[model samples]
Target chain A: MKTQNIPKATIKRLAVYIQVLTGLKRDGVEVISSEKLARACSVNPSQIRKDLAYFGEFGVRGVGYYVHELISSIKQSLGVDRVWGCALVGVGNLGRALLRHKEFALRGFSIRAAFDCDPYKIGEVVSGLEVVCTRQFKARVEELGLEIGIITTPPERAQRAANYLVDGGIKGIVNFAQARIDVPKNVPVEYVDFTHHFYSVAFNISSME
Target chain B: MKTQNIPKATIKRLAVYIQVLTGLKRDGVEVISSEKLARACSVNPSQIRKDLAYFGEFGVRGVGYYVHELISSIKQSLGVDRVWGCALVGVGNLGRALLRHKEFALRGFSIRAAFDCDPYKIGEVVSGLEVVCTRQFKARVEELGLEIGIITTPPERAQRAANYLVDGGIKGIVNFAQARIDVPKNVPVEYVDFTHHFYSVAFNISSME
Candidate 1:
């Protein structure tokens, strides 16, 4: 189910809504109103209703949303309900940290393997998972049947990692490198830069001033 | 100068605009119109003009904007000219990776020191900088005369990390912690989450589908 024509901001918030729904379910909450859900997420009430309206009605007119049902529905809407196996190409600090993070599995994405270039770190058990050397990453990913790869290599190594992931038949990538890599248009790449975090800090500081 | 209620999406785009402006300056462009800027960023031309209007008119009535001047102004507006000395806490995977990154330095932010409880990491240098032990973190931070703290600690350890930074006299915090923490009202805390990146990825995938 493709949803275009909506603002990217709205799409991002929908994911936040799903996270809120997850919290509600864990609390054994059965029903949640737009007001309650918005408050829990530190957002406006009408915004929650407005965003949900884009995907058709998941909320009852008076009863609000059925927590578990909404969680399942949002999962389907996000296309994250299906089991996803991902490969991580950099076993450096960021790569290893992401692997040890159990939250991804809790959120429906499982990392099947990790790769690195450092001979010392290579073959070392990192975050409870053995690190495979970068030399064999292509074959290891192929053997594991991973369709999505995460690129957490250093900026200098980011492009090379992307090329290897592409050659491995991975269709999607989440790049954490500061370096921007050129990839074919058909293959989607998402970049997550914590450097943006510093900008936001400055933004808030400027706003205060 | 305070931005007059720009959309968060537009503020984000402003960050991109600043980057592109730097590229244009390097290429020796004197002036550029909205259309060319849009083409470079893959955005709609009218949207760029509209986003710019929230602030005072930077472009002449017909001549577009002066590249070098615009870059200088945006940098000032973004607080990029000021050096923000930061303490890096929780030298886990994400922390270690960030220590090696130079983007923050390029943007005028420095990780003066890093902290972690892991005895193995505390006394060692990971990226040409020593990782300070968490036990002595507060004292070391004051010793360096730093006020900005980067919290790259885990979800469970996030609050405690903030507490330490607060006691350490940090006035600004760029937090990568998944969980929120309470700092004094005067202290500006900017939170960046990996899960939020996941939401953007999920959003992009859903829209593509």
Candidate 2:
């Protein structure tokens, strides 16, 4: 539970490690050495060992880690073992896609409600959840006990949506919009920036040439 | 330019720094000290200095960095100063959202082609690009000289889509699927995994509680 000093990079790596471990578990792999796991994740073996060391030891002295055990441990450490209720704002194309996205449900995060500012989008059902107006965002979020807020609105509307989430007392935010929104320090925000990945891909491809 | 030995983390940070710098430039800010830039990016000032050091010196001795100059230099170093042609596979909701996403075009990535296996999706125009069959992926990629292949297909179809992209001679891949895929060593792949962010957010929220 000593999360205060853990590096953000370490947390992100733990997520990746759990993902790879889940895949290994699916393949019926019982145990995996840090070296093998590192290779699978495209990370340095020493880095993998160091990252896991933040949460205490996991791997055996010689054999390495039990795939299932490591997956469960990491999932528990990341607080993803139980489902988290989430509310999503903006019912645009991107928002609709996120609503229909199966990965969120599969990964223990559930979109319990959807919200939109457009009068036309209001009352429209997407992915089994009826879209509500932003006016109801805070009340609905509080009523549903939604802990996470996902912003998928356009750049101009992102801040307003973020304010609504903040007013709703959302614990964490996942911003898919291209704009930066201000929120209190207590409410952690994670950006799902597609352009960053595009830039990285472009950099690597350009480097090769 | 010396591209070898630059850490992947540095590359990702560089992308973020550029985004922050772009925002500053938009606000009409001309020069910014490393400390200010780091604060905006939520990165260490020394880390920002070190990341920029990989490319070469940019800031003056005591005046900090010229925002426009630094932005251009970073973009040049990242190889994003010029536009890169890209292809998107799978015309699903996510794929359509990506097609309509304006950030990619703004960041110099152009989705020149789209592919899908579904007969209904094929021939349909979404975001100005007509959907094509997977059978035509390789040929269209080669003909259009697309360097980046974006896999937005279902997890089950991701690997096959990757195979087609590789066969078509893609330089890099942006995999939006939840599936881990295999591509040639030369073709660097970046994952846009939403679950990773969700897990991180969940962990932070749980820790605060």
Candidate 3:
């Protein structure tokens, strides 16, 4: 599939569609119409069709889309069909939560290792993996073949941790810190800021009033 | 302001712009151009202007925007200028991290209370607030006058927690559970799914390759 300049929103919706389809597949559902998919995703049916058209057509006339087939195609398009090894920096509460989250494993993403600067946390085993010192981040990332790095360090140390991850040759960083950290152009960073999430929801709630 | 049909994406961006501006404000920056704001936000200048235009003009020609003024306008538009009381259910690792996050307090969203099903954790005081049982969710939400309910419970309990919150008259729900919970029509739910964030970053990282 020719992927060029796909809108970020579309990419996000694609991920959402994959999630919805995965749920449907688990429910023993076979085929689903764009209308059904749209309802599940809270998107318009035409929009769903339009999004799919970008990656090439997978839908047949009248019969809608085969659930498992569509999911497989999306997984391939998303480059998540293969398992990705990721390293977690900062074994704090947020990092601990993420490491314990089972959805990552289900979606082919695994936390191969965790790192922290705290001496108390260092050498402690969490989720069956020992929390290594952040000083060893670059070398450890390389040694573990980690592609993505998750930053859950405190705000003051976030940028430094990001720098370490970049130096470690990480392809991406999922930063949970509220502070924005600069990274190289080639390395994308996704901010999973809980504060921003709270604001988004609060604003949405306020608008309802 | 005629806040009729503003897209969720627009509202989310507004929240992000608030974050960027807040950072700039702390740095003692007084004024900024849309181009600069867009660069800081990782969005196009035209898109930033378009978003602001939806809520009426905030930028002056040639001089661009007054940093403080723009933040005020965005906050007002987002209905976050005033403090919002939110009830948090499930004081797990992720929830604990959120309660400890200083950004939320800075943004005027305060966690007025917390809840959990665990007997050991139920009566424990965290961040100056005692954790109540989920059984007390509805009554406590009412007593606290919480405008929003945040669900960080496990998948199985999410829907039930949502039910109590809704019954207690929460204007919205910010759910972090991996499971999708159904809510009332008037009450909107914002999902804070970490898996989706990971996939978004993964797709972007894949595109860089």
Candidate 4:
């Protein structure tokens, strides 16, 4: 699929759509209209059609969309139809939380291994995965064929974790650190900063006043 | 200052610029040009100017923006100059991680109280705050004067927590749960779904292929 040039915001909504559709499918919903799906996803109906049109036509004239087929198509477009092994760096509180988060496995991204520099955390078993020393990170990533890396390290250590992920051949990263880490051009890094979320809410509430 | 109708995206980037400017100020830098700030923030200079223009003209013609002055101006516009007390519902691993995260306090959002339904977690201190029973949630929010609520609870319990927050008079929410909760029109909710971040990286990597 020629997936280039799709807006990052649209890519984000695709994930939300996947979640909404998964829920609909589980409820035995066989078909749904764009308007209904938009309501489910908290987006507008026009946006639902526009985002999906970037791929191809899946909606029937009268029947709306087949819930099963749309889920399959969105998953395929997202490259998450198959399982992707992931390596997590930093077994700190946040890392441990993500390790225990059940949704990742349900969505086909598995945290196959975890690494940390802290001696207290090293060799600890969290969420059934033994915490490995950071020195073994590259070798372990190669062994496990980790396609993506997740960094939950403190700000100071985030850059080093990214370096290890890159050296280990992991191409994608989900960084939760507040500090921005520089990565090579080809490596895709997604930041999940809650501080930004906090500030956004604060700004919004202040604006309404 | 008339702050109506400013795009939420611009408010978000202003927060980013505030962080960048704060860092520059700490480094003893006196003044910064939009070009330098743009490079630091990974945003275009034109966009930075446009975002600031929504607030007011802060940048001088030739000297660019004074780091200290711009930080104060942006903080005033975003309302992060004042601390926002926050109540966190759920003391699970994710909730514990957030309670331990120091960046919230550093950025003017304080997680004052934690709540959960788990008997094991209730009354236990995590990150210096004792986990209160969920029944105490609304009362604590009233006592603490919490303006924001952070929901890290499971999907099933998310809406109930939102109900508690709303009843307690929380006007803003930063929900980390996978579930969607309906709030009143006046209460603005911000969702921080890491799955969206995960899929964004996956899609970006897939597009590169």
Candidate 5:
């Protein structure tokens, strides 16, 4: 398939589609039309086709897309098939919570080392992941060839943490920190600010009420 | 204006519009055309017009949308003008981190109570918000007239926490717990499971890498 600059929205939807397909495969379903996929994703049918079309002719003319085949394609396409080591900085409450999660394990990425400056939490294990000293982030990351990191540090310290991760040679970052981090041009940053999402949620409820 | 059943996709974009408008307003932009708004939002011009037209005619045939007025209308449509007193269940690390955030304050929702069964944390003021006993949820909620809640409890206790919140008169809930809570048809529940969003994020990163 020819390379296309797929919109970030489209890429995000691709992940959602992969998830739905994975679910369908688990449920013993095989083929799925754009209409069914759109409904399940709470998106328009035209959107599903447009998004899937970006990757090439994954869908047949009449019979719809194959579930298991698409999952493999998406997994390979997303580069998730290879083990991507990650470091979780700031083993705070949210960081600790994420360390316990199985999603990272399934996707071939795990927080093998969680770094923190908090002396009290250092050397302790959070969800079986070691809480390493932040000072060792560069050396440990180099040793493991870690590719991604998560920043859950305080907003004031988030940028410093990001710089630390970037210097450690990580390319992708998922920042839960409020203050946006400055990553070099090559790094792809995804800000998962719960406050932003929560604002909309609270705003919606209040508006409805 | 007629009360039209705007698509959920359109409703979702309204939130994005508010964000874009807020940014534009901060920059002292006096007026913005649909194309420009779409550019800021990364959506197409036609989609912007269709979305804006749903609420009523905000754009003149030639003058485009009045930046401040459009923002005002969007804010009202998003129900952000009013304050919503929301309780937070489970004052774990993630929950505590959320309590200190100022974004929610600007959005007009305050975490009135943080509930946990841990006796060690009871009576401790987290970010100045009282950490209350789980046993006191219903009474405190009734007294406070809380209508919305955030369930940050672990997966095991998620349902019980959800039930307690709902029974106490919460009409809406933002569940961060991994478990899908069973709710009566009347109650509205939105899950913001980090695992789910993380899966999408990492999956997308892998796809494009």
Candidate 6:
């Protein structure tokens, strides 16, 4: 499959679909119609069918989709069928929360190593992963064969962290820091900005008034 | 402004622009051109102009935008010009991290109250806010006049937390739990699913390989 041709929005919905399907599979839901799946995901039924059609037909014409089968297919398409080792930089409260986040492991991503520059935090063990110096980031990431880097450092240190991650041969980055760090075009970076959601919610609430 | 007519993507972009503008303002950037702002935001200059046009004309054709003025205009349009009091349910690690997050307060949203069903955490104070019992949710929210509810509870408890928030008269919700929660149509809910980012990065990396 040439993923480059797939719409970014479709990829996002595919991820959401996988999350919904995983939950349904856990609850013993074997089959789900497009309407039911759409309702679960807060999307239009036709939109779900359209998004799924991008990859290939995964649903029966009239019956529906098998939850387990759909999950496997989507996971395979998203390349999350196997574990991807990841390195986490900055061991502050947010980073610590992410370290203990079970969803990442459930989704086949592992935070194998942690890095920090603070002397007090450098030797500490967090969520069972020892905090290593940021100066050793490139070497440690290479040693652990980590593919992705998660940046949770303060805004001021985010760029430096990204530089280290890039130097460490990270293929992708999930940045939680508020800073916008520059990276090569080859490395895909996803920003998890909490304020975005807050602003949306605030706007919606204020609009109601 | 009847925000209803604005594109959702525009609203999201506006949030991103605010983040970038805030950083620039902190660094004492007084004015920025459309092209320069677009480069900083990783967006097209025309797209920025279009999004801002939805609200009003803020940028000078030749002189560019005054950083401070643009931030104020966007914030006012997004209804984040004033502080929004919010209640956070589920004082777990993720919830605690959110409480310590400075971005929310920086962007005019305050987590004024925290709630948990756990007896051990009920009386605990996290990030200076005392964790209250879920049983007291409605009363505390009413007393504090919190307009937004942030759910960081475990998946199983998310719906209950949302229900409590809704019953407490919350106008909006930000759900971090890996569950698709049900809320009234009038109440908006945003999902902060970390797995979505992981899946996208995993797919992009796989495509590269």
Best candidate according to DockQ: 6
lDDT of 3 by residue, B67-180 (tens): 999998887877778898899988887788777767777889888999898999988988888999877877776677798888988777888889888888888888887667
Task: Report DockQ per prediction, comma-separated.
Answer: 0.40, 0.64, 0.56, 0.72, 0.20, 0.79
Q: Indicate whether candidate 1 or candidate 3 has the larger TM-score.
A: 3
Shift of residue A112 alpha carbon in model 3, Å: 1.2
Fill in the DockQ of model 5. 0.20
Q: Compared with the true structure, what per-residue lDDT tens digits does model 3 show for residues A99-168?
A: 8878888999999999998999998999999999888977776678899999988777999999888887
| Residue-level lDDT tens digits of model 2 in B1-209 | 53656787787888788778888888899999888888888889999999998888889878999999998998888888888999999999899999998888878899999999999999999999999998897778767879999999987799999999899888999999877788889998999887778887888888888
Candidate 4 Cα RMSD (Å) = 1.7
Candidate 3 segments exceeding 4 Å error: A59-63, B60-64
Per residue, candidate 4 scores C-alpha lDDT tens digits across A104-198 of: 99998999999999999988999999999887888886678798999989877999999988888888999987667789989998877777788
| Model 4 lDDT tens row, B68-180 | 99988888887888999999999888899899988889889999999998898888999899999888877776678789999999887999999988988898999998877
Query: TM-score per candidate, in order?
Result: 0.80, 0.92, 0.91, 0.95, 0.67, 0.98
Report the C-alpha lDDT of model 6 over A1-209, residue by residue, as the tens digit.
Answer: 54556777788888889888988999999999999999999999999989877668789978899999999888877788889999999999999999998888888998999999999999999999999999898787667989999999999999999999998789999999988999999999998787888888888877888
Error of 1 at A79 (Å): 0.6
Task: Indicate the residue-level lDDT of B152 in model 1.
Answer: 82
What pairs collide in candidate 5? A77-B207, A78-B206, A78-B207
TM-score of chain B of each: 0.85, 0.96, 0.95, 0.96, 0.89, 0.97
Rank ordering of all candidates by TM-score, starting from the highest: 6, 4, 2, 3, 1, 5
Scored against the true structure, residue B110 in model 6 reaches a CA lDDT of 84
Report lDDT (CA) for all predictions: 0.75, 0.87, 0.83, 0.87, 0.73, 0.89
How do the residues A1-209 of candidate 5 rate in per-residue lDDT, one tens digit apiece? 22435576666676667656766877898998878877776679898888767666687777888888887776665556567778899877667767776666865677778999989999897787778878788998878778788888866788889988988888688887655567775677776645445545555555454
Q: Per-residue alpha-carbon lDDT of model 6 for B1-209, expressed as tens digits?
A: 54665766788889899999999999999999999999999999999999998787788879999999999999989888898899999998899999999888888888899999999998898999998998798887667979989999999999999998889888999999989999999998988888778888888888888
